[model samples]
Target: MKRIGVIMHGITGRMGYNQHLVRSVLAIRDQGGVVLKSGERVMLDPILVGRNGAKIEEIAKKHNVARWTTDIDAALANPDDTLFFDAGTTQMRGSLLEKAIKAGKNVYCEKPISDTMEEALAIARLAESAGIKHGVVQDKLFLPGLRKLAMLRDSGFFGKILSVRGEFGYWVFEGDWQPAQRPSWNYRLKDGGGIILDMLCHWRYVLDNLFGPVKSVSCLGATHIPERFDEQGKAYKADADDAAYATFELEGGAIAHINSSWAVRVRRDDLVTFQVDGTHGSAVAGLTK
Candidate 1:
């Protein structure tokens, strides 16, 4: 068995709780855990590290993980730990990652690895210099629809990909009727949240993997909602974008158009979808069964 220790931050946040703790880590443990091709078991020993002790305890109890803490230094100093997994807010990610790398831990993180390209590149360089194994979560590629599309593309079922069109949106109903589901921080520019930065990270990987590397891009964005109420029922101004329309030209002459929005309603069954056209044939795919 390969013994591993993980320092997981932001366990109380939405993405951290839903995606990392429950879906990824616990689910991995539930399936008799990760196994090497040689039949060795990959034992994942995760230490839930977060600011909220009560929430951390609650999550840990439900998941059956024993180790939990709010102290970053203590987690790093432990000799048994080998990995640092970060799902923190975008603004805090760089500093935390830099500290983790300096402490000699292999890193796995959620993406738009930094709010800016420069910070992102700096982290990349640090990882390279430290010779630490690193990965950014490109989880959308693992979704059933996208995975099937990938299989078809790899089998040459669609000859040569000529163009890709993507549609992604859902109406964020106001709190008075349906209650606002998204965090208030998302609507603020300073919080490193916006439809463009949030969704484009997924697009970056998808286009590169399925279509081709993007050579150039032009985009337009808008905030359809001007104001919103915070979780505390206080009024707040929304300064970030709620929608984006972008066109990308790929290295191999493939063109991609993307529409991402939070102000639109989902009338159909699928909220996000794509269609790829090619020389031999075409395929239409969606985030639906």
Candidate 2:
């Protein structure tokens, strides 16, 4: 078995814990790893890293991950650990990736890689200069619905694709009665949080691949819920925007309108929905059937 040792950062976070560590890596581990085209079995060995030693250890033991560490520098120094995967907060992500690259480890992570374009570019450039493999999550394109969209595009099912309309939002409970679903840091600008910054990053790749290059964007944002409760039930001012109304012009003269909000209740077929219209056909896709 060719076991790849991956040093995973921020696996205790929501997406990091549930999606990446559990649904992805552990799911693969439970299946006895993956068989290569050459018939060699490739397995994964993950070392969990976080600021909280106790939390990281708990997760590691719970998931049967072999190692846990609060010392990232020590983990990076391990010769057996060839890959560095991060699902940490966006503000710290660039620095973590830089460290991994400098250590000569292959890197992958959830986005946005950084809060600013300059920082994002710098990370990419560093990875390139170091000649290390790197990638940001563009998971939307892999969805069954979006994959079908790509198929339609590739097959010329959409004759001269015209436009795309996206509607995405849900009512996020303030931590008064029901606890806030998202982390409190996501509501603070200093911690790299905003509806536009979060959703637009996802939309960037979605538009680039399915529709076309985005030519320009005009956006208006709002922080609908100003005060929200934290995990400790303490209320704090939400400086980040909870909602955004944006319009984009794609390269092929296609106009896209998207409304993303966290303040609205869902009554529609899907929490998130996209409508792609073309001369030949049109289709609607959502979070679920």
Question: Best by lDDT, which number?
Answer: 2
Off by over 4 Å in 2: 287-289
Q: For candidate 2, give the lDDT.
A: 0.89
Instruction: Write model 2 residue lDDT over 1-289, tens digit each, in one string.
Output: 9999999998889999998999998998999999999999999899999999999988888877878899999999999999999999888998999999999999999989998899999999999999988998887788777777788789998788899999998778888999778888878898888898888888878998889999999999999889999999999999999999989999989999989998786777667789999999988887453
Q: Work out the TM-score per prediction.
A: 0.96, 0.96
lDDT of each: 0.87, 0.89
lDDT of 1 at 220: 98
Report how far residue 127 has shifted in candidate 1, in Å.
Answer: 0.8
Model 2's TM-score against the true structure = 0.96
**lDDT per residue (tens digit) for residues 1-289 in model 1:** 6878888998788999898988888788778779888999997889999888888898899889999998898998887998999988999999989999999999999887899889999999999999999999998887877887898899998787889999998878645546788888888898887889888889888899878899999999999887887887777888899999999999878899999998787775677789989898888888653
- Which 10-residue window in model 1 sums to the lowest lDDT? 170-179
